[model samples]
Target chain A: MSRKRSRNIFIATCITPAIMLFALFMVVPTFEVFRMSLYNWGGLSGNKTFIGFNNFKVLWNDMRFIQSFQNSVLLIVLVAVLTIVVAIFFASVLTKEKVFATNFFRIVFYIPNILSVVIIAGIFSAVYNPRTGLLNSILGLLNLEQLQRQWLGNQDIVIYSLAGALVWQAIGYYMVMYMSGMASIPESYYEAASLEGAGKFKQFSAITLPLIWNNLRTTLTFYIISTINLSFLLVTAMTGGGPDGSTEVFLSYMYSQAYSNSTYGYGMAIGVVVFTFSFVLAAVVSRITKREVLEF
Target chain B: MKETKRINTDTLYKVFIYVALITLAITIIIPVAWVFMASIKENQEFYGNPWALPQGIHFENFREAFVEAGMGDYFLNSIIVTSLALVFLLVLALPAAYVLSRFEFVGSKFINGFIKAGLFINVSYITVPIFLMLLGWDQSLRQIFDSGFFLNNLSVLALIYAVTALPFTIFLLSSYFETLPSDFEEAANIDGAGYFRTMFSIMLPMAKPSIIIVILFNFLLFWNEYILALTLIPGDKKTLPVGLLNLLAADRAAVNYGPMYAGMVIVMLPTLILYIIVQKRLTQGMTVGGVKG
Candidate 1:
């Protein structure tokens, strides 16, 4: 055989399997989500009908979807703000300060990130249990029993409860991300700022912040995407959108509509919205947070 | 006089930092350590103070979790699925990543862009469609075989796990491959090594550090993955996380707490041990490509 022919054949052999599998599993199914949204396909019923955006029209009036939309937005904002502040604080401390046992704290903080969301759900369920929970019991011991309430059982507070778990799991991962960014900042920048009589807070805002602004901006997008995904997973495992659908996020509602309600069409419509929503949100966030990249 | 005030304020600042750091550390450590303590506590002890230590070692919860709650079988299933998925992922990803990054081939750029776009495709949205597609295949196969094949099959589940992981794995591996000096391949070619021979004996071995990172990350991913395992396997064959979810539900309904906590430990222990051993590498691996699912 010719040498060129042999090279072409080798390339084909190497990439064909991965491409085929990617198309079949990842590409086709993703396409199917969009296409199926335009049809009324009832799962397990062996009937699929073309509906032409009627599913989306129905979703417009879906009170449950709207509630889930609100819940998801609340979670996205709460988790992003809380996790970012706490994580950046801890990351700066561990990176800049000569704290004792810095390695121990870094390793311990990341423990929650390594475990399954299911395990986190289980842990928080124990922490949030009303009569026998760690949180309430601690309150009791501190003589602040009036502050204790049904952490997961109260409708007014359950969404916040989910937010807390998400923030807890997320802080370490983003902390480490920021720390890596912080670690890369040249120390000369900080020394110069200190020479100008900059306090710790001033130096952080002026020097440490802008140098890592690109990393911070990138994590803003991550915060949105991961918060959406994790809130669903945690809701699935912990609350199942429970105590009367109080904690239902986007994907959990989509999942219930798909499986529990058996309305595959409606579920796919929800999926399409979420997919577009995330992309748009990320783009808007990235646009708003855009800054001139700094070279150190 | 001014120096004394500055020293006092500096001391106060140091004290404040310590308090904040220790508070965050305790928040994380106490819950995990409490779970370990709770896993060994007797049933009666759980009714008392949540802060109280376990009175004595009670290993029976683990026995119940492993045997009665079926975590033992689920653990074995997880081992099989995770290992199989990793093997499939590396086999498929390494070659594709190798050729795509190193060689100039037709459609390579388009293929690269296509795979890069797959990074935005989260599994949560596509899961139901994949489930339906598998169900459709199973239905077609049932005509001839008188049974189903795609759904509830461990190998098929493993294949899906690997496939879903392709974008990230290939993206990471491709970047690593792009850094290699082409002179190694040039020298190998002059010595009469074919493409496969060079990749297998020369290029792949040099990629060992990255291959380890891929395995470690994906192992945790596949082991802890539950939604796909839950939906795809509607039957008895379940991964560790899905099984633990079931056990949690059942035990919660029955008000059985000890076995539930034990099940949590069972699901998390492997990942924890693995994390502790390779955490430095794992966190460092994050900055390369820096995407999370």
Candidate 2:
């Protein structure tokens, strides 16, 4: 009995510090943010007026907030679809033994995955810098100067450019996921399909796709969450929610409001909105993708 | 038995596969090659012959990036923050994961779910609030530790990274510990080893692979992290990402692409090398962990 008590104590002691830290740092602050959303605070001042949802009311009516939310949604859709499609395509191609220099190709592609967003943003900025950018320079050499346009500064095409950069960064990660899924597929399934005269394409369609449905679903979930979360860094570096807020996503806009604009209450309200949106998105994805476990 | 026709068709398919794969490889390599070429070229050469190889290898850009841009400090800061955070994450997460995985107790499910739910809270969503909290702490704590406590900025950033890494670390380690046989632990317990002893002496050594995975994941995540570090750490203690941003701002008008590219090359090399070294383990680890979810 004494031994069991000591064991329990040890476990409790081991977990307490972490739990405390997490509670203090993550949970408490999260709740505080929620509470602060109800007030009109200027930040760093004692003059926090009790607004009671006025900030949220402002948030609801704010055009920038609404547009950023839409942009966030659009970004999530574009990045998620592109990443999955590109990843699966690469995964399928790389799995074949006949594919020459598979390891070399894998290494080349994975380079972008490991790069910091700052570096990627820098690289793309150089490549897209209107005057001497590689793209414009190439077009100039081809005597197609009229075709060249400002990639980052151009409001209309900026979002697509940002998406392109994101896809470039993210595709390698999803490819790793898909390749692993493909690797786990049983060889016997392929053998059976081959015996029945199923070609590679048909086999992939019927066998591999269905088999890796779980991975696909998980990748989709990761894509959505990360797209919403991490893409802010790229957006900040590349555009700064710029060319008149055309590329503003929720996170960047919230950042500007809080740090730059000093609209603390409004920023907290946006945070709440972001939290609620993410929670709903996650719950919905999980529900839609939920399936009974496949016994292999 | 009709195997001859099958062989011929297989050969044809092989040719088609190679063609498709080479195209994919070219697409992947082109951008990287472009960056490498630009990094070595002069600004004039870049504009004049963008696609051509550099007229001369300009290795001085690397020096300028390190010394002039103060990327040396940034690199050191990144290393310190990432390493410290990784250590803290592993230390806290391992035991927590162990407890949650090995023992079923009151609130265990809730605790596990709580930690896992953190994965959904998009780090960006919490960044503002967390930054405000840190700012408050910094202001208060500054009086207690004097100016020396400024180094605690790294600790604060590390704490955040460690917390953020908790969900994935716990989730991965729990699955790993679940797969470990209970018999070894039971035997150790029967032989007068306390739970801590059994866990450390028996289970930990066995769980080395999972530990490595945890370390690698935490390392990569913290290393690449920008927003958290940017918000938390002020000037003079800037990490690589923030340093790069500063460099960009300082050079935006001058348009010196050479040193900027060199800085990028420096920042990217560590992660690129680490990725290559651990590519196999990373692929397998993420696949197993990801699929389980």
Candidate 3:
């Protein structure tokens, strides 16, 4: 065979399987998500009608959908804020201070990340069980029985309960991420700051924070996307959007509408909105948090 | 006097840091250790105080979870699916990543762009559509073959897992591939190694660190994955996580809490063991490719 011909064959042989599988599974279905949204398709039936934007029209009025949207936004904000704060603090301390058994803490922190969301759901179910739960029992032991309440049962507190689980799962991953970024900052900068009589907080604010601002901004986008995705996964396992849809998040509701309810088109519509929402949110966040790249 | 006062506050700050760290640590440790303790606890021990230690080691819960709840079968299913998906993923991703990173072909940039776009397509979004598509294909197959094959098949599920995982796998592998100098390929060519020979013998072996990282990361992902497993396999055949989910639901309704926690342990123990073994590599490799689904 000619070299050029063989080269063409090699490339073809190398790329075809991956691209074909990807095109079949990933690309086509993603397009189907967009295409199916335009149809009024019911489950397992040949009753798909071309209903343009009408599914979305109904979605606007869906109180359950609205509730899910609220829950999702609430989760995104809460998980992102809580995880980022705690992760950054721990990341800073672990990287900077001389803490005892830092490796042990890091290892333990990441345990939640490795376990399945289903496991987390089970763990929290135990932790949140109203009668014999760890939380309530602990509160009782601490002589704070008044603080004991339904951790997952009450509609008012369930979303926060879910958020707490998510934040727990997320902090370790993000902390590791931030720690890597923080670890890369030159130590000389910190030494100079300390030499100039700058306290630890000032050194963090001046040297570490500004230096890792770009990393933080990037993770903010990650926080948004993963939080949206994970909230759905957790809700599916934990609550199944329980207590009259109080804990329903975006994808969980979409899963119910599409998969369970067999309202395929409606579910796809929710997917469309979520996809666009995440993209726009990430873009806006990236823009607002954009700072000139710091050179250290 | 000044130095003593300064040291006092400094010591206090250190103590405060320790307290904060220990507080967070306990919050994490207690719940997980609680699960482990609960897993071995007898059914009656779950009644009074969750904080109470198990009166005795109740191995029955694990047996029930393993045999009765079908977690044993699901554990096998998870192992099969995870390993198959990793195999399929590496086979597909490695060559594509190598060619894309090294070779300049027609539409390579566009293919790269396409894969980049695929990164944004989260599995949750297209899961229903994928299910529907497979269901449609199954409907067609049933017309001829008299049975459905697409849904509920482990290999097909594994394939889909690999396909959905392609973009990230490709992205991570290609980034690693792009770092290699052209001299290796040229040397291979001088040694009469053709493209496939070069990739197999030279380039691929060189990508071992990356390959290991990919396997480690995707093993956890595929093992822990349930949403796709739950949606795709809407049958008795289930992965561990889905089985655990069912156990959670069943045990909740039946109030058989022992088996439920046992199921949780069954599902998570492998990942935990794996994490403990390669945690340093896992966390270090995580920075190489940031976001995972």
Task: Work out the TM-score per prediction.
Answer: 0.99, 0.91, 0.99
Q: Residue B81's C-alpha lDDT in candidate 2?
A: 91
DockQ of the candidate models in sequence: 0.87, 0.53, 0.88
Best by DockQ: 3
Candidate closer to the true structure by TM-score (higher is better), 1 or 2: 1
Candidate 1 — which residues are off by over 4 angstroms? none
Please give the distance, in angstroms, between residue B286's alpha carbon in candidate 1 and its true position after superposition.
Answer: 1.0
Q: Could you give candidate 1's per-residue lDDT for residues A45-100 as a string of tens digits?
A: 65999999999999999998999999999999999999889999999999998999
Local distance difference test values of all predictions, in order: 0.93, 0.79, 0.91
Look at candidate 1 and tell me the lDDT of residue A33.
Answer: 91
Query: Compared with the true structure, what per-residue lDDT tens digits does model 2 show for residues B1-293?
Result: 58998899989878877776676666556666677666777767755656777889998787888998999988998999999898889788888888888888778888888877765555676777777776666667767865434333787788788987787788889888998888998898789898889888898888899898888777777887888788777557888888888777667769787877777777777887788799878766776675211
- The digit string of per-residue lDDT tens for model 3 on B1-293 reads 99999899899989998898999999998898889899999888888778778999999999999999998999899999999999999989999999999998779999999998988889999899899888999999999999999999999999999988889999999999999999999998898899899999999999999999999988888999999999899998899999998888989999888988888888878888889999999999999988856
lDDT score for residue A201 of model 3 = 86
